[model samples]
Target: MTDPTLGELTVGVEGLALLRLLHADDRGAAQVARAARMAETREVLERLGREPSLRGPLGVELGLREGYARWAATYDGPLRLFSIEEPPVRRRLEAWPVGEVLDAACGTGRHAVRLAGRGHTVIGVDQSAEMLERARAKVPGGRFVEGGLTDLPLPDAAVDAALCALALVHLPDVAPAVAELARVVRPGGRILISDVHPFLVQLGWQAQFPVGDGRAFVRLHRHRVTDYAAAALAAGLVVSGVEEPALTPEAARTPTTELVPEATETAYAGLPGVVIWEFARP
Candidate 1:
């Protein structure tokens, strides 16, 4: 399939913005906003006519290995998801007794370093060797292994606790990975998981990152609340707690927001950015 053009993206944004404004109780104000959105759409069409090159591809889609390798260099930069996901995950991780903790899909050792610092023996596993290299370098004392989340490198009941953060969304089916986590943790040991909420995925969010002048994205899958609950139960894990932290306006903003700030912000406002799940083996 051909990558969507910039003009196509702009038109879609304008349509969404107008749809968001059409429901205002103040009909007069809504009419004015709709007119502005229409004008913006018209301007994009005119520009595309004048410069046909404006219809060039906006981004390229990449596989997980290639995407993470390209992203590893700038992975430590200010990512909004990390900011929102870290606080809650950290709170729960800190609450656990400091024992061996498995950081599955532990890109760049973001959580492994902290677990190591807190005196827990950290075992970090990830599919991307480039990311694992960064993780190894960042947390020299922690054990970093190159491995997939569905087939962990450790034995059954190997760790006291496990954390799989912001990674489950990448999997098309989360059941195998969930079962793997359940298998690795000892009985009564806890597991913590954080992922992009399925709501956002339904709203067309993908794992996007910058690549030179254009953008690149890795497609994400939607794993609903029930999907997770069913998988955990089937794996003999009980849900201890769940948290759906709403996105801050800043964290919710997307590149398209620049064109329709109010409409875009309104669509995402008060929406949960990530879902955190805490499970325990009985």
Candidate 2:
């Protein structure tokens, strides 16, 4: 497969800007912004036509195994989404009665460690063995298993609650995983899920992180709001609440910001950065 080009990425960013500007509130200022974006896109296209290096490979794209393995060493380091996703999720998780909690796709036991500290018996399950190793060390008393979300390595109705964080976007279809999460929780139990919002995905969000001297990105699937609703209904889980956290200025910075800071900021401003869902088994 051909790696995406730097020029292509820049053009994509410009395209995103144009898309947002064109569809946003039809005010005179919006029209001005939309026209400016079109002009910027044309200039970028002209430069791409003349520059050969810009058309070359951007960076390495890795599969989940290789990507997360390389990421495990630094995965616990400062992460932007963690700040946006964790607070609301932790509040809901903490409110639940202390009991067995399944942290599905629980990379490096970020949530598991905290839940364990709060006297909850946390069981963290992740696909990456490397991540699980870190999770084991962090929460020695908590159980850590190498498992996938769709086919969890646990018995049915084994946990009182479940939390799947920033992992569902990796799956092409979220239904199976939703059903699996439901299967593992007892009736009347709750499940909380957090992920990069579909709007961000449409604007080119992915599972990206540092690897060695460079960077690697794992492709993310676009799951619309309806998709989550259907999955929950099919799994017999009731949607209690949904939260869409808007992007903060700090979290909106991107690699392309250097090339077009205004476009980058404008593209992401006021957009939802993450989506957190609360579900109850009925």
Off by over 4 Å in 2: 22-39, 49-53
Q: What tens-digit string does per-residue lDDT give for candidate 2 at 47-109?
A: 888888667755677888788888899888856677778889888887899899999999999
Q: What's model 2's lDDT at 207?
A: 74
State candidate 2's TM-score.
0.90
Q: Residue 57 of candidate 2: its Cα lDDT?
A: 59
* Error of model 2, residue 95, in angstroms: 1.3
Clashes in model 2: which pairs?
none
What is the C-alpha local distance difference test score of candidate 2? 0.86
Which regions of candidate 1 fall more than 4 Å away from where they truly are? 18-39, 51-54
